[model samples]
Target: MSQLVIQDLHVSIGDKPVVKSVSLTIKQGEVHAVMGPNGTGKSTLAKAIAGHPDYTITQGDVLLDGRSLLAMEPDERARAGLFLAFQYPSEIPGVSIANFIRAALQARLGESAELDATGYYKKLYEKMDLLKIDRKFTSRSVNDGFSGGEKKRCEILQLAMLDPKFALMDETDSGLDIDALRVVADGVNKLRTGQLGILLITHYQRLLNYIVPDFVHVMHEGHIVRSGDKSLALELEAKGYAWLKKELVHA
Candidate 1:
């Protein structure tokens, strides 16, 4: 089974520490949700694992499929089967969605193999149809002039076509209304097969309502202060973080 292991992770920007001693393990077919207030390093942890240069990993290791990923460059890590869905999807001004994804798949094939255009578009349109994305989206620039919901849907579309072993979705429900959230969540749910494990990071419990997680962890001050099954998310939703903080302080 594919696995992503995060062990004693400590991250920082310059000298200011953010993620402190956070540890977790996600296996294929499991969905783990990481919840916390802002500035608690949720995004930092995701970026560091995905090899973003800005967030320095002062300590700890992130392993994928039992191999250390710390030494690999970001693109190398991606080609090795890790996918990170950014909180803020960037706009590729001139690249169409079809060409962008095709390039990514071609990279995975290395220099010796030729890309099959017919097979590629067949799969692309299949994924778009599954995700309820319009076929015309293929010709549009990646995330250019898309609404917040459209951007999130585009992210899922990429995820579907790439079919990574593990997906780190950061705040996927951000800026999405109820309808868009359901659509994005439905697309994600369809993608959750035994070959795919997910680490979903979000601040609000409402997102959890659509994409139910196998496990829920509450992050506080850069550490996961609480963890449990899906019911834990319901508790967090009912009581809120303020109650959790008070309980932790008194405990």
Candidate 2:
């Protein structure tokens, strides 16, 4: 089974440490929510794991199915089945969404192998239909001039097409209206299965109401201070982070 194991991870931006010895394990088919206030290093952890150069891993190891990912480059890590859905997806002007995803998939193929264009479009259309994205969207530039909801939905579309074993989704619901949030949630829900593991990072419990994670982790000051099932999310939602801060101080 595929699993993502982060052990004693310490990450930094330049010389300033952001993640302090945070560790977690996510198994295939599980949805693990990482909740924390801004600057608590939730996004930092996800970016570090995805091999973002800005966040340096000062100490620790990230492993995927027993293989150490710390040594791999960002592209290498991606090809190894690790995917990060950004909080702010970049705008790639002049590049069609279909071409962008096609390039990514092509990069993963063997040198002598070729992607069947007809087959590729067939699969892309199926995934687009499933996500409720218009078939005409394939020709649009990636995230260019897209609405906040449309951008988020575009990321989900990429996720669906890539079929990564493990996905780190960072604040996917940000800037989305209720309708857009539901659409994105539906796309994510449809992709959930025993073969994929997802680490969902968000601040709001409202998203949890839709995605329904298997586990919830509360992070504070770069460490996971609390963990529980879905109820924990509700508790945190009602009580807010103040109680969690107090508990951490008392502990």
Candidate 3:
């Protein structure tokens, strides 16, 4: 089983400690939600796990299965089946969506093998169709001049094509309308399987309503303060963060 284990993780950006001893475990077929208020270092935690250079891991370890991911480079981490769908996907001016995804898939293949272009396109088209993406979108530049919903959908499309063991999705519902959010949630629900684990990071409970998580963790001041089933999300939504703050203070 593919599993991601983060143990007592401490991350910093320069001298500022952003993630303070945050630990969580996600196994295949489980959907884990990390919800918190802004500036709580939620995004920092995701970037640290993805091996982003700006954030430094000062202590603790991140493991994929039994292997230590801390020792691996960013590219190596990706090739090892870890994927991060960014909250704000970058725009690739010159690269077509098809070419970019193809390059990523090719990188996974060793030098001895080459991807069959015909088969690759067929598969890409199939996934695109499943996501309700237009056939013409394959030739468009990645996230260039696309709407907010389109960018989020593109992220989901990449996840479907790459088929990673673990996915770190940060604020996927950001900037999306109700209809768009539903579409994205449908894609995510369809992609969930026994071989895939997802870490969904978001600040809102609306997304959780659509893509009901198996575990919901409330992060306060960089650590998980509470964890429960999907009901926790609804409670947070109704009561707001102030109630959580009060509970933490009283605890």
**Winning candidate number (lDDT):** 2
Residue 237 CA displacement from its true place in model 2, Å: 0.5
**Lowest-sum lDDT 10-residue window in model 2:** 107-116
Q: Residue by residue across 82-171, what tens digits does model 3's lDDT show? A: 999999999999899999999999999978899989999999999988888899987999999999999999999999999999999999
Candidate 3's TM-score = 0.98
Model 2 clash pairs are none
Order the candidate numbers by lDDT, best to worst.
2, 3, 1
Candidate 3: residue 129 lDDT (0-100): 86
Clashing pairs in 3: none
lDDT of 3: 0.93
Clashing pairs in 1: none
Give candidate 3 regions above 4 Å deviation: none
- Per residue, candidate 1 scores C-alpha lDDT tens digits across 1-251 of 88999999999999999999999999999999999888888999999999999989999899998899999999999998899999999999999999999999999999999899999999998898888889998899999999999899889999999989889999999999999999999999999876799999999999998899999998988899999998998898889889988998999
lDDT of each: 0.93, 0.94, 0.93
TM value for model 1: 0.98
